[model samples]
Target: MRGYAIRKAMQPHRLTLKVWAVAGSFFGSLCFVLFQGGKLALMLFVIVSILSIYLLLGKWSGIRKTAGSRQLMNAEHETTIEAGSSLNVSMHLQIPGIWPIPYVFVKERLFHKNNTEYTYEVTLVPDWKRRGIFEYKTHPLRRGFYTFGKTECVTEDIFGLFEHTGYIELPQQVAVLPQIVPIREWHQFHQMMKGTNHHSTTTRAVRETTQINGVREYIYGDRLSRIHWNATAKTGTWKSKEFERESLPKTFVVLDRHSQGYTEDEQFELAVSVCASLFHYGASRSFALGLVSGGAASQFFEPKHGQQHLKAVTQHLIGVEADGTYPLRRILKEYVQNVAPGSFVTVISPEHGESMLAVLHWLKQLQLNPCHIFVSADPQRKEHWLKSLKSAGFVGYAVSSLAELPVMLGGRS
Candidate 1:
């Protein structure tokens, strides 16, 4: 039994050498023997070695009993939490052992799920009993999925000679959801424009321009593709195809997540806030809503109405960053091609670049009503962009902050 205990206790350990203790003890014992003769030296050596060995054996037994026990955790934990919230995890350990660990210390290590960031390590002094239910709390700052990985319950023998670490697997996941903001502007704008509620059929099933109902005389802004070339040539008059809606219409919020799109982090965060607000508003009304964001990987959520779909989208948005491998125009054009015409496309961008210009031009060609919103840090620049957009026959809104969004879109700014 002693041999087995020693082997188990000797598995793996960290040494915290107490230099002062060693040096003092060694010299004191040496001097005692030098002054008091061979008897004192012989007695001191035997007593010290015996006591150290006994302590090692005791530690071996304690750890072997604790680590070798199979059933440790008794309950599961919450797998999700909102950002800026604390998560409390409760765990019960039933290790059949002595009540008190006289001269040993227990330790626990906290780490991120990915193990990329080292959180902290806590040491528990030898207590009356360390075996019981434990409550751990974590405050993760970033909005993303995180988890508690491994808990190392370590114990060091008396005199800090050796420290044995026994790992207890703690597999718990927590998904930190993104911050949601309420959208006061969208509904307020709806009440003013078209003079109807946003939830009404007019806004819900808005007419689509892709479904052609008939052909009519071409207008000045009609694209060549929309012109009936053969008919126009035969009649010597400009004839254009007219398109209408066949299915349910929805609102699609496209966020420009390109690195150069936003002026800074604040602008990008505001864009995300706007998306989240729209998501909440649209989901609550059961309105089919879609989102298109440009980043390292394009995220395109098809228009759908449900709580489940909203959850999935929120999870994606929580980790979404303003880092795009492709131009915002590419992502916009891709989703726009499949979107229903007459559907509201709310384009949120801070920078007015050529890519954005191309998307607007494409939307115009398709006869899709695109509402371009330019979030500006400079008032002068915002007016200039608005003028350029209006001159090109597009509806645009310029706002210094998100608070002014509703008023500007309502034509009441």
Candidate 2:
């Protein structure tokens, strides 16, 4: 691809060389005709001059009209996918006129939020119908929002003396969401907040209300009062009444997006993955889950339990960037009031400095059970930060990768 780009960049110089060669041939033919006085030399000079003029002007006479003509180009791909998943992109181009194009060069550009870019070049030989399709599969893409820039189609004259380029607006967007590690249970949530004033449980097993939502097969520990006699009589098996339990206290996953905290983009990505895993965990168990990011543009999703809510939060995570100018402490200080008392706030960040410790203390003072998930690349540094957080009377977990998150949170793979 690099070589292709280099060759493409030098195409104009190639054209210039072709023009000079044609001019030199024309002058040499003229000199041969003047000095040698041969019929072949006169014929060669006439042919060279006419060919050069046609190549320079006549070949490109209708190029502007061809380019201005409506050309349709569309790119299709999976708009959303989990991180580390490959994406397949299909592009189709329809040229308006049958200008006898030998082939077309298609250049596709994928741009990330951080100004990172990936370029793909493919050659398409238009059929008799003046349409072509090109398909390519990308490598596993990281978690981020990616947009396709305009697709550039370049076609050269049959003689390869001149190039005409046209751009088709693709406007295709793909979002690679942060990967979610399956977590069976988050024991830290239960163990760390055991004696908290607000009732907090790992799952939605809080005190059941009298309103029966449905009935299901009887579990061993179901209370006698919860027996569904009607369901049992109809199904000829033990049945239990399922009640609409009171909503659990909201769990807010605070994603630390301060630019200064992360040494590498991967660390920030790890933090985002942790947050996404927690959201998945909450959604699966019907917990009121929310996301809070204090980045360049602060985002807050109110605690809610539904697929729609999860989708909205996931969309936000897809495009979220670590562009926060303020530290976590200051950002949270401004947004802390939005959180209710007795709520669970899990701060996911790579920073474990005094500033983070201060944020934890502040949250504790506000009656919020604060937990820290420290993301770092260095093992020794992660261990040290975890110890410091533990010593400060905070429940902290260290995670280096998505695979380790389940185990660190007291869940299996």
Q: Which candidate leads the pack in lDDT?
A: 2
The candidate maximizing TM-score is 2
Model 2: lDDT to the true structure: 0.78
TM-score of each: 0.65, 0.76
Scored by CA lDDT, what does every candidate get?
0.63, 0.78
For candidate 1, the lDDT comes to: 0.63
Q: Per-residue lDDT tens digits of candidate 2, residues 1-413?
A: 99999999998888788878988888898899999987898888888888777666635533233331221222124467788887777676777754567888878888987788898889988778777877877777898888888777888876877778777775767778888888866877855445453454443245557777777667565678889998899999998886775755667889999998888888888888889889988776567877789988999888898889998998899988899999888878877766788889999988877878888999999889899998987899888888898889998888888889888887332
**TM-score (C-alpha, index-matched) for candidate 2:** 0.76
Model 1 lowest lDDT segment of ten: 68-77
TM-score of 1: 0.65
Candidate 2, residue 197: Cα displacement in angstroms equals: 6.6
Q: Which runs of model 2 end up more than 4 angstroms from their true locations?
A: 1-77, 96-99, 191-206, 210-243, 411-413
